[model samples]
Target chain A: MTPLPTWQRGMRGWWRRDPAFRRYLLREATSVAIGAYALMLLAGLGCLVAGPAAWQRWEGLILSPVGLLLQAVVFAAAVIHAVSWFRLMPLTIPPLGRPGRRLADGAIHAGAWAASALCSLGLLGWLVYGA
Target chain B: MTDPETILIEVLRWHPDTPEAPWWQSYEVPYRADATLLEALQTIKDDLDGTLTFRWSCRMAICGSCGCMVNGRPELSCHLLLRDLAPGPVRLEPLAHFPVIRDLVIDQQDFLDKLPAVGAYLVPAEETEAAAAAPAAPSRQTPAQMADYYQYAQCINCLLCYSACPQYGLKPDFLGPAALALMARHDADSRDHGQAGRRAARDADTGVWDCTLVGHCTEVCPQGVDPARAINRNKTASARDYVFDLLLPGRRR
Candidate 1:
């Protein structure tokens, strides 16, 4: 006797299949913007090392409409990445707090957001006053 | 609004003997407010069509045998009431990422084979010669200790997680969610000493690494067993083990 045909519903458009999958894909896709921003920063550092004239040229390009637009997109992506990362952080790590008492997931998220806010404010203060 | 007295349940049907492909065959199941999808299926099987086949054991969700795709999402048929999906067509299909055996029944041979492969059971701690000679005693655990793995222990091997997992659909070789969660369940048990033996399976490429944390496994789970969390926690453990194995090979646990 011949073997029966087992129906295989392949993973076609898997990301679109479920809301969770779509969110996962969106979170993963934000890395492209983050990586692009990192590369731009690296290039700016190279320009600074080259000469003052090169540095000025790089600065001008960064202050351009396209550059500002790209930066805005990257910033949005970074915010999304950071939030999603923090939300998932508790899951990846072992249960926090003492043996009997474990930290709530909300506490982890709040702690992460607080830390991020503190760092951002510190960076902003340094840029405005220290510089 | 459709007729309130009856609900249409569209079942994906397949047969080995037939030349036709798997197709949607709708049944008008007499709907009651409290009737579950399992009851509706039973109605179809008992009165409407005897050929319509699906797996169900405990009418409650404990058996985990009644899992199927209800309206494209993996769900326990016994748990979903007809009142919730009222007055319309409810599409039922075999769980995704599994080979269809018949109508609403999937071949769970792969998942069944993976259970022991991950060492989802406990291995007692090595006993001293004197202890070994004595009569065996129960290795007790405190409430706190039990809490560590109690959530994972609730897993009914429903296969809904596997159905919800796109990674399992894409890469069938991936150990998938429920089995990995079971592995974590045993690993977290205070009485279980099987972590060292189960390390190889957990550290493999197709192990915890394959999960991109889509997290639908946790969502679709009727038992509230967070397989995504279990797999990710093991990812951290596996990463630590990797570093330890590299830096101090002999000292690696």
Candidate 2:
């Protein structure tokens, strides 16, 4: 093949520069934290199956300083993941409005945020009161 | 109103014939409130440096030819005013994620190759036409159907979305935003009946599956065409089809 005289640029530290790309990288990385959390939950389940002492040991490990910090990081990652997911929610579905008057982007964003807040609050209430 | 002042424009320069790699060339151009980056380049070509090369036609955003990197962001040079970017200097470069052919001009052959794979044009249904009625009759469509793909149809094939897409940057095979949006546009149209033929493009490893929904495509769009929405919505469809094909085999089809 004849060599074409064209310059191709490489992608390095792209996320480091643009906020949009940075957020996208964060959103992608949230899955690793989420996966780690799942593994921890599975380990907890295994401990419960082993006996009360094992369960207690697992629980202690989870609630420890390091564990708590890890949990906090995971929680933050999950929140970021969820917010990003909901932001794309409107786009996945058809627009919710008439022809000339379409749903505003502000409305879509607000709706997603509102729904997220309501669900989060409900979950908190359930944890505090019911569970 | 302020007096017109000369502002420095640092443009990335390169040529095939030269042994040297790409470098920046700065030109001082007289700036005005209404003048755009396109006009600045035009000024550079007309008065200052005649060697400056870039592709542009129809100074309006409608042409979609003047997309370039303005200070590390994909923007229509025709649409972005110099006054809004007022300062001593502004950086100009070819659109990212593509091969640079020359100063301020990137290769679009990859995008052109990908567009045909997605079946961007309308494929009409087999005509029964209610016992061979009027051939010239307009295809009637509901407002709701029009709303489905109208935004996607606004795409001018600018390839700014390609520049903005990190996924496309990483993997060149990935059918970038504009092509996928065009695919969705045709699929969503009431007159079109070519979704089945276009499934390979939609479900390929380099298709909608590649999009991470970074949404920079939507952000950088000169027209409000949301390629992220079209790509993501089809992800759901492609995933559903995958599941159905696995479980039901030929039943789903």
* Model 2 chain B lowest lDDT segment of ten: B129-138
Fnat for every candidate: 0.59, 0.63
Q: In model 1, which residue pairs have backbone atoms overlapping below 3 Å?
A: none
Candidate 2, superposed: residue stretches over 4 Å from native: A1-4, A94-131, B1-4, B129-136, B246-248, B251-253
Evaluate model 2: give its TM-score.
0.89
lDDT per residue for candidate 2 within A1-131, as digits (tens), equals 77568888889977764788988888989999999999999999999999999999999999999999999999999999988887777777665677658787778888888987999899999999999
Clashing pairs in 2: none
For candidate 1, chain B by itself scores a TM value of 0.95
**For candidate 1, lDDT tens digit of each residue in A1-131?**
76456766778787776788888888999999899899999999999999999999999999999999999999999988998999899999988876468898999999989999999999999999999
Across all candidates, the chain A TM-score values are 0.89, 0.77
* Residue B37 in candidate 2, Cα distance off native in Å: 1.3
lDDT of 2 at B214: 90
Largest TM-score belongs to which candidate?
1
Scored by DockQ, the top model is 1
Clashes in predicted model 1: 0
Per-candidate TM-score against the hidden true structure: 0.94, 0.89
